[model samples]
Target: MTISTTSTIAADAADAMPPLYGLKVLDFTRVLAGPFCTAMLADAGAEVIKVEPFEGDDYRQMGLQVDGHSANFAFVNRGKRSVRLNLKQAGARDVIARLAGWADVVIENFKPGVADRLGIGYGALSALNPGLVYCSISGFGQSGPWAEQPAYDTVIQALSGLMDVTGDPAGAPTLVGESVADVAAGMFASWGVMAALWQRERTGRGRYLDVAMYDCLLSMMPTLVSRVMAGAPATRQGNRHANSAPFGAFHAADGLFVLAVANNRLFAKLAEVLGQPALASAPEFATNQDRKRQEAALARLIEDWASALPVQEAVRRLTEAGVPAAPVLSVAATVASDNAQARGLVVRQRPASGPAMCHVEQPVRFDAMPRGQTSAAPALGADTLAVLEALGFDAGAVNAMQQQGVI
Candidate 1:
């Protein structure tokens, strides 16, 4: 399901119709990375039971509230059940143990060894349910030199050389605009979970996944790693790439547009489109390597030429000349773009107590042959009673569990 996972997977529900339907996943993750990964499984139709703590996921309090839940929380947790449980309490462990027995997968994002301390670590639970695809996500891996240190997205970025390669030539090194490290790790974890689940069907065994944000970030550092390995100088180019010249943003009369004259052919096309065909074969700009040697002069020429043309016309000319160009669009612009609307990216969701929610639809669309009705995110504790009953907890046990600070 991911771009990187190298495994043979069967065409399960996740790959066919509602991909994750009929599969029960216990999600013990919070914040960006873990939630984002499980959210992917949920979007594909997994019955994700988001097991929250007694105090609830911290993101529930972030952003604008929608019917007692934050929009931030609702966006990622839009199709999962929430059951509150206090894991520190003895009563809660029994409930979690029961859920583990019932669940097909378990995802957690607590700090290193926190789950072990709580007795829900893979070693303990795998003994109870060998078929569970247990996954743990953290800033660092469960074991290593820096496993126990506190980490945030920025810390990982700084430590992994991502930040060092992500800024303007002379600008301060910037963290990625979004939590890319967390997102990458979550995505990787999700891929691992699905692979493990599919493998379990054939092997009748589950796998434990250990995805660390720092390691994920490091894995994504292609250009930076290459340069470091080769001992090449890495400049701080805010919007430019060290791999190629004329591959950055430029301002047109109307707005900003990005262009990537990546190779010699595109560079020639760019020069001719700009009515400077003579520059196409000029000694200082003939080859990509030569252009990089004279990047300052080349950039100045592009800026001067781009300044006189309107954004749309400039983009049109470049496009017509076999070059890539596009306006830098904001969220509003993207939502309103003709291409996005045509692709059916804007989906409508109507929660009973609130206004209709217009959110982005699932990015993974089947081949128009999948079947089944979609499921929305569950209300807080909406399925608690049903889940308890299914677990063979009679009425009295349910009541007793609730009274003992467990759901």
Candidate 2:
């Protein structure tokens, strides 16, 4: 079997879209994980329809509500249409089943059994729509003992040892500033979706995906899990690699920045640049292992040395010396960066009032067509009628369905 990217319409179809133009996605995931996955798909030219319960996504209420919707919600949900549907309500399940039959993909983030209870599980969805790529995002795998437990990003970070690996070594272990688990899970889910889409072209069938936020975070555990597997207990080492020395952030004379000396060669170069070349050969810092053993003394020596030169000067000297170095950038500094502008990393759109919407570009770039943007996130149920009408529902039917709380 082969999955082909052929069009249902004629060649040079004038009313055409970009790649994935004919793909249709039904998004049932809420908050961060599911929404982000669908957003990426939508940005790639998929017709992603986000199905929210009549009460709408919790993200619509939480966080910063702007223009009658959450700013964060708007950021993730731009370029997608909203169709309000209460899956638990009478008449709603059939509508979703219909949507599933028409869709190429179905994304949901309910807990393990929640979808099955609602008759929207992958088993049911795939049965209704054989070609459906059903993606289930959760805290754990479907059959695990911990599958039923609820998990947020903070909990996931803690469970996956990411928390233990963050923060200052002496300070209490802390969660990364952002929701690392949700973001990673969303990215992994998107990866799975694209993989399934590619395979579907060959097999003429789709597969069910199980993405756990906890597992996603664990997959990104850096050296923590591997080291433990190799006989090292996970320990909290703030701002430092658990195994590498002189591979951490240091305070330079004027400011702070990171210096990642991945291997002994870089460490030796770093030492030489700091005018302490002898220390690179000193018994205490002779090798990565020995340097780790004398981490306190090594840090003291490096700090004392770096405290002499200005941060930019130190960075320029090290960079010129072929060392990996970077200045720590605050949010404001990042927003104003020339690199940010030159790379087109941020997209600024004009509005009549208030500040123009400054959006971060989708991280992925294709050598072909660049990304396109729609107006900001929809108002609650903003595209309800238009999307439904496109889906073959009459205006009267949609209004009645909304009144019955089946939307």
Q: Candidate 1: which stretches are off by over 4 Å?
A: 1-16, 64-68, 354-362, 369-376
Listed per model in order, the count of residue pairs whose N, CA or C atoms clash below 3 Å is: 12, 9
Q: Write the per-residue lDDT of candidate 1 for residues 1-407, one digit (tens) a residue.
A: 11111011225544454546567788888877888888777767677778777778888787777667577666676667777777888887777788888789999999988999988899988888999999999999999999999888889988887788787757778878877888889888988998898899999999999999998888887777788789997667776768788888888877898899889999999999878998988988878888878877887887788898888888998899999888898988998999987877766666545545554534777664232233444456666777667667799988898888777
User: How accurate locally is residue 302 in candidate 2, as Cα lDDT from 0 to 100?
Assistant: 68
- C-alpha local distance difference test of each model: 0.78, 0.77
Q: Model 2: per-residue lDDT, tens digit, 88-152?
A: 88777767767787889999999888888988898898998888999999988787888988998
Pairs that collide in candidate 2 are: 1-202, 2-201, 2-202, 3-201, 3-202, 84-407, 85-407, 168-238, 169-238
Model 2: per-residue Cα lDDT at residue 15: 38
Residue 75 alpha-carbon offset, candidate 2, angstroms: 1.9
Error of 2 at 195 (Å): 2.0
